[model samples]
Target: MELELRHLRTVRAIADTGSLTKAAAALGLAQPALSAQLRRIEKALGGSLFERDHTGARATPLGELVLERARVVLPAVSELQAEAVRFANATGALDRFRLGGTHGPLLGGLVDRIAAAHPVAPVSTYTAWSVDEIASMVIDGRLDFALIGACGESPPPLAERLTWEVVGVDPVFVMLPEGHELAGEGELELASLADESWANVPGDGCFEECFATACARAGFAPVSVFETDTASVVHLVQVGRAIGLCRATFPPTPGLVTRPLAGAPLSWRHLVGWHPRSPAASAAAVTVTGATRAAYAEAVSRSPSYARWLTSHPRFGTVA
Candidate 1:
């Protein structure tokens, strides 16, 4: 007989509660039925899954191994079921479009543009720090389109599979507390931050690579003393805990300031990308591209220094 989800859940319940009676109650099954089910499962595997005693039920070594797999499989199955339910409930949810991108105002703009014009379209939105993460989701059919920020002069490793449009280029700036001496300073050297702690979120993409490379070039390696998300990165810098990087278009956060590096050194080549398989991918790319460009302009308006840097370095976010 094929193993069912209930069989797995029953094993988990028995292991978690450590008592057959409790596990049966938790699973809403009678004690005899649960015991019979466990016996059948154990017989199929040619082993006893649980040991019975006066104290309680204990998983055998084999049972322990099975439970380890259960942890990973259960959650994924739950999410799959949930996603199925959502799509089923929402008519034409996947048929119209889906979008994903890096977090911040640009993502918001991209989502809004698509949603505004096709208000009833079955749309899904997601965000990630790594351009590769966004690109993978697009290629795997999770997202129809993505807007990503690449720090290097070229598209990310997976670019060949998808069409990319550079909506705008954004300079990378060091975010520091307003009270810090280097706040708003023009063209500061990377070495100046060498003595300071860095705050970074774990990412496999340009964020970590660029920080490592640029700091390496500056004759130092950045030590990320704290790992956190975008909002927390802002908070970490605001409290004078650490320095972090952001695109020039990041909206101004209170109690913090952003300064350009002297050489126009590190910036992201922003692109709106999509897999060509979808008939609507080209149209989605246009809407996302325009929204991203407008969002960059809005971000520039919020920071005068960043705008000047963008104006001075016309090739800031371009790839040759």
Candidate 2:
């Protein structure tokens, strides 16, 4: 009959939602099950949290006091966990190489290289769609390094505690179906695809805004944009439903082709970051960054069209 963090969270949920049924739904519990749990919690606390009626549940005075304490306790506990991890990492207590990345080709290559170089050391990876999420994990010591991308000239995650370095740069390319009329061309004008609908993987970055600005400079706003996952973007382009924006190194897909825009109006910058205070800052960062650059080169070599395009555009491709 002791109260726990879960009990506090349940109480807070009931207060926030203002109904037992709503709180149950929010907490992913059956209404009856939530009620039973709440009854036990109330008995432990020696008072009911909410006065319930047909209208809805309303927090009593004791509930308000508990809610206030929960607001403090939850965040404190979270910060403590983060600080503990940071301390462990700073003290060299963590022996494994932990990497977090936004969905891309670089992570796998980097992981492979790290594992090969350090056969006895453990290496793990975490992938997410958002660059900021990956960067935050590095800052919180949940990851030793982060592999992410940013739109051209845009800064990496705003955290000052992390050090970010460019691993490579790539002109954003347009993905079209193999049968597309423009697919045969060496390069396409952004304005040429003015009327075409677009699809791209959704993420937290400046890419979407940069795309819109580039299109505006091309003298036409996109007719439609379907924000979705990478697989869906490929499917949309393959079916001729929409064109997709991708890295120049995007691997060749069976039904799709990627061609650079004539003016290189858009570009992606590959970056690797780590908390300067973490174990990765010693020598692992340099090793991983070098591996990532080499990986980018391999990716470019695999994409024949991109490799040929790089030959013509000397300024683009893997960063020095």
Candidate 3:
């Protein structure tokens, strides 16, 4: 007998459950039937797929290889079936969209635009703090699309698989307490404050490398007095313990003041990325590109931080 989908499914079930009896129960088949299927598959291949031990069934080396291939093949087959069914029902209407992104202030309006554009379509959202995690999820089919920063300062070997499009640009600001000595300065240069203590997020944080790179560009390494992975960097800045950098579009907090970096390369571009081959990804790419453009326009109109940065800086206008 030739290899078939059922044979692959049985192999996966046995590998996952580690017992023929439980695999049969999970598959809604009698133990004898499941055993026969396994035996037939092994015979066709002229080898034993699993080792029967006192405890249960365990996959041999060949069986493990088959299971790995099954994982990729099964998901593709299932998605194809689902896509065909959806096409039949909607006659080519848009289906669900899976999205991932870093947690940043601009995401609020971006999410709003997607919601308004597709009122009835289901959207799945995931927030990733690091670029690698987002890339892995997209490659493994967990996410159809993601919005991420280009990896350079944070880590090496960036998410190189997905196609990326720049959507928005924002300046990095130095967040300080209201009564701090640097608060009086109109624009703070990184070199002017290199001697000051800094507060940083942990290694996997989105801004950690950006902050380090900025300091390095200023010709000095920062002395990180505190390191935590809290969502809000403003909290650390407000306590007067250390100064931190944040995106200019971040909402203003009551006790914090942010000034643009006058000397260092302080701008970061927001990017929209997706797997090239996924049908769902292609659909999401079209919708998000249009929506992000509109959202950037709206942001410039209403957000004071965006208006000031975009109008005064020549490079900011090139985003999107």
Candidate 4:
């Protein structure tokens, strides 16, 4: 028989209270109206749903079956109502901010800080491989801000139109497998690996262009065989299949090592960009950008390799 949510709620209430008068009172309905609803349900089912007893009213066999189903159905309906209320509260009241960054160190500490600092507002982060796509998202109002790599040779697109902030610079490192021929070398000269197959981040001009130019300055062009933007490029390097170029602040893992390129110039810089037109963009951008720079600084201070790289190359200073 076809039954509605109100019918199930009425049955549960009657079963709980053990009297139609009490059930109607609990449900905030008139006694006659509640009686009519129960009678209509019983008629539809083609059976008597309750038996009159000295104590009060009790369920018949058909009523017991309906009560069992109502026990399951009523609570589910209540829970759905609660969830609707929660969803409405979350999306309707809280301010939302969207931020995009390259697949690198920019997103690491900023995500946690934003969550802790702004408990009420919702923040979203996206990883983009291409600088052009990130710039487009910011310009089109799809993102409040974007954190991207910038180099002295090729900086990010127009900053005058959009408010730009230089968060930090991530030193580029050459990733190589454990026990590889050059793994034991204290430092690498970029020209030596001219013919070696390289793995690169697809559509990310920062790493690919920087590494290629570094190699060209050392007098050779690298042959890149595989291209991907995943953070696991270090894993590919660890397997000895291909060498990778990655940021210095990459998470530490066993069996992998990053060393400074002895002869190459340090040029990689990370910048945070936001559209001036977005109302919530400045505050959100400041929170994320500040956290990101602080994390990079703390991470570098703790890493011996980063320390050595910095000491060896004094000209490469902190980016604004």
- Per-residue CA lDDT of model 1 for 21-67, tens digit only, reads 99999999999999999999888777988999989999999899889
The global C-alpha lDDT for each of the candidates, from Candidate 1 onward, is 0.75, 0.88, 0.71, 0.72
| Structural RMSD, model 4 | 18.7
Clashes in candidate 3: how many? 0
Stretches of candidate 2 exceeding 4 Å from the true structure: 1-85, 89-94
- Better model by lDDT, 1 or 3? 1
lDDT of 3 by residue, 230-317 (tens): 4446677888877876666556677888788884376666677766655554566778877766665665565476567666686663
Q: Which parts of model 1 are misplaced by more than 4 Å?
A: 1-95, 223-225, 317-320
- Model 3, residue 117: distance off in Å is 1.3
Query: All predictions: root-mean-square deviation over Cα?
Result: 9.1, 6.6, 8.4, 18.7
Winner of 2 and 4 under lDDT: 2
**Full-model lDDT, candidate 2:** 0.88
**How many residue pairs clash (N, CA or C atoms closer than 3 angstroms) in each of the candidate models, in the order given?**
0, 0, 0, 0
Give all TM-scores, in the order shown: 0.65, 0.73, 0.63, 0.64
Best-first order by TM-score = 2, 1, 4, 3
Worst 10 residues of 1 by lDDT: 85-94
| Candidate 4 residue lDDT tens string, 1-320 | 57898888888788889989899999999989999999999988889888866576789999999999888887787757644543443333227757788776657667676777787777888776777788767765566677787765565765645777776665567788887789888888877778788776776465556666677788987776578655557667878878877666655667777776775465577677876655535465666667767766766666677766777676553554
**Ten-residue stretch with the least lDDT total in model 2:** 86-95
Model 3 gets an lDDT of: 0.71
- The residue-level lDDT of candidate 2 at 67 comes to 92
